[model samples]
Target: SLEVPFPSSREAVIALRSLSPDREPRKGGISKQLTVSGSTLSWSADEARILRVSVNSFLDHLSLVLETMEMFGSPVSQ
Candidate 1:
């Protein structure tokens, strides 16, 4: 099981929505589950590699979103 905490509930929901549909049909006994509550995301998978890949993909998208938000969502104080 993997649990990730987001900076805000809205960001967590965005991450959840962005990652929820990433599951692909597997031929083996591999299975994956994901859930979101408040500002956290929890994931469970049968295989380590599958989980790693899924997490990597999710992080990639999450990074993009966070960067975008930083770019446009608010003015950064310097």
Candidate 2:
């Protein structure tokens, strides 16, 4: 089980939704279970390599999304 905390609940929910689709085990015997509560994301997976790959992919997508959000989500209050 892996638990990750996001800066905000909104972001945590977004990450949960984003990573939820891959919950089913793939043909390679890889499975993931994900859930979110408040500002935390909980994930469980089988197979080390598959877990690593899946996590890397998710992180990549997350990085892109965060970058986009920072760029366009809202104007900074000065």
Candidate 3:
């Protein structure tokens, strides 16, 4: 399994809620059951601790980011 750490977290892929049938993306799980080991991500979430973030868990983070952006304004650079 591959493990990559996101220092800036700028490359995080956020998912859109509304989508057409043909444009709809597949959920992150098929590979989990098929492969012996899945990819792991290490992001600064909990006290900047490097933890085991599965594909599914990482996707959830993306989805949450998309949803929050839809509601709140974008983050400004300081």
Candidate 4:
């Protein structure tokens, strides 16, 4: 488990995964909705770090793209 991130929701995901590798675990998804400030916020966290890692990766990619655009120019659309 140490091969992954520290004590986090992701660790829980991995724990569940390890317990049921052949099939999906029946645990409820993490997160809840709140209505406040005349608005609604639906925040959630997965037991797996997959979503967090993906978000990080997305930010990294965006940063790289911005840096590249600053250094070079906009990429040509395909």
The numbered model that scores best in lDDT is 1
Q: What does candidate 3's lDDT look like per residue over 46-73, in tens digits?
A: 3222224344555565556556756875
Deviation from native of the Cα of residue 65 in model 4, angstroms: 0.6
lDDT of 2 by residue, 24-63 (tens): 6577564676778888887777656656766766777667
lDDT of each: 0.73, 0.70, 0.36, 0.35
**Residue 64 shift from truth in candidate 1, angstroms:** 2.0
Q: Which stretches of candidate 3 lie over 4 Å from their true place?
A: 1-53
Give per-residue CA lDDT, model 1, range 1-78, as digits (tens).
788887777777766777667567778754887778887877888677777766787667767866776777653343
Worst 10 residues of 2 by lDDT: 69-78
Model 4 stretches with alpha carbons more than 4 Å out: 1-50, 74-78
C-alpha lDDT of residue 23 in model 4: 30
Estimated TM-score for each candidate: 0.62, 0.61, 0.30, 0.28
**Candidate 2 residue spans exceeding 4 A from truth:** 22-30, 74-78
Clashes of each: 0, 0, 0, 2
**Candidate 4: tens digits of C-alpha lDDT, residues 1-78:** 012222334333433333233332335752321111222222224334544544554446435534554577433444
Off by over 4 Å in 1: 28-30, 74-78
Error of 2 at 62 (Å): 1.7
